[model samples]
Target: MTPSISVVIPVFRSRTLLPHLYDRLASVLDGTNAGWELILVDDASNDGTFEAMLALHEKDHRVRVVRFARNMGQHHATLHGIKRSKGDYVLTLDDDLQNPPEEIPAFLAKVDEGYDLVIGKITGDKAHSLSRNIASRTVQFLVGKILGKPKSLSLSSYRCMSRRAAEAMGSYSGAHVYMPALMLGSVPADRICNIPVAHHPRLEGHSQYTPRKLLKLFSYLLVNHSSIPLRFMTIWGTLISVASLGYAGFVLVDVLANGSAVTGWPTLVILISFMSGTILMSMGILGEYIGRLISENARSGQSPVFEEYP
Candidate 1:
């Protein structure tokens, strides 16, 4: 049977949540017009997760398993599954059950309304920690500004993409995966829709992401997807230059008007420090962009080696 929908779930030590997730997914997608296949990418889990997935595959032919050679991050695992999927639409979600499988139909419905992508938006109380929430919101704001999308739209892994969108996204190769931003770059805003979905507390295992990882991901997006950081650096450098000129004029006037030598070493030290710091900061921003370009070109020139399962 040809599957109309391909559901990709990235698994990292998520053995405990499989049973309930499978049950809910089966119930919700059983009678829908769209035929479905679930692709689970095991990110080199050492907790017998691969064995469990093999068992599940034996029990149900619709469930397919792909094992990574190493613990590539969640986004890499997702890309792996996307490459293997044959369905017309692809949906990616977490294995921890934070995103309910019941909402899959709603996402599909939105996608059917001619939208290239439909993202799930969490409404009501958020179950994440305050710091996590803040970090996520900050990412959302920066992503929207950089991508020129509406700030109100939230990007989650629990989203559905049309076949065209999936194909467009499959061409992207990067260590960092901000799917929403990537998709926004390829597809227009009007073609994207946001559907409200209920958020739930995690039923098992701790979140794999930390605040530091969040910041790192944001930095990657800023460096890779947009030049806003460089623009800000340019503006900052101009402002500092203006301020320095103003201060130098003030010092000259003071010296000339009072007929006294300016003898404060501290003021000279502060001015030099500020100016040097600004110059170094601007160079650092430029360095980041140049480094990213170099790395991307290197990766593009190299041939990726893939291992096939027996």
Candidate 2:
């Protein structure tokens, strides 16, 4: 029988928190007295996370584990879990215990209210670094703007989606998978809602998402999710071209009026440098899109290989 809810957690370098998370999650689900399953995807963790997942799975038939051959980022691992889930409603949460299992009831309550997708918006201070918060908010803002998310809607990692929404989202086979972006793009704005959820301080290791990784993530979204960058390049290139032509006309008139046959080397040098830089910048944006296309074409095997499963 299919479970009423499937909780998906992407396990990275979180070996220490697994047992506690499982215990809490088990108690929480058991209290509901509804059929439920837990899907934990080990994202190629070098730590002994896979072994721990195996132990958990061995102890509980409801717990299923998926192991990746290589670290393919959080979105990929979560996508794998979503695909393997047998629940009518799918919930994704971080393994870091920061998003407490205690909040599951609230999420489920909201889900029962007929929202196709419900995101657990963090209420208080998140235990992440300032830089992470800034980067995350920036990404969220851009995603909201590009995806036309409602001003009231704020996407988070801790969220629940109906099975139809999950299946629709899982159908996307793009190499660069931003789960929030994909969800917003696939599902209608009216069907999504945000519920306030408690966020606790992290009880363990450092975050896997470094600033560099965040920057790369933003870059991917910029290139693949929207045509804004290309449009910006177009607008800037046109402005530069028009300004250069005007400058050229000014120089020609100045030389003509002054009756000087010698060209101003400095003016010519500046114009050439400016035009060269613009051309290179435009080419670089095009190259980024082309690179993404090549990657998507070359990509294969969407499912992460399972080391073990129930």
Candidate 1 C-alpha lDDT tens digits along 210-253:
76667667877787667667667666766766676667667667
* Number of backbone clashes in candidate 2: 0
Query: Per-residue lDDT for 1-310 in model 2, tens only?
Result: 8899899999998888899999999999999999999999999999899999999999998999999999889988998899898888899999999898888888888878888789988896577898888887888789878767787887789999888778877776877877877787667777789999877888877889977778778877877666677667666766766676667667667766875565676477457856765685677667567656644542332322211265
| Candidate 1 off by > 4 Å | 249-310
Score each candidate by Cα lDDT: 0.78, 0.81
TM-scores for candidates 1 onward, in order:
0.80, 0.86
Sequence-dependent TM-score of model 2: 0.86
What lDDT would candidate 2 get against the real structure?
Answer: 0.81
Judge candidate 1 against the unseen true structure and give its global Cα lDDT, from 0 to 1. 0.78
Each candidate: RMSD? 6.2, 6.0
Give residue 134's lDDT in candidate 1 (0 to 100): 82
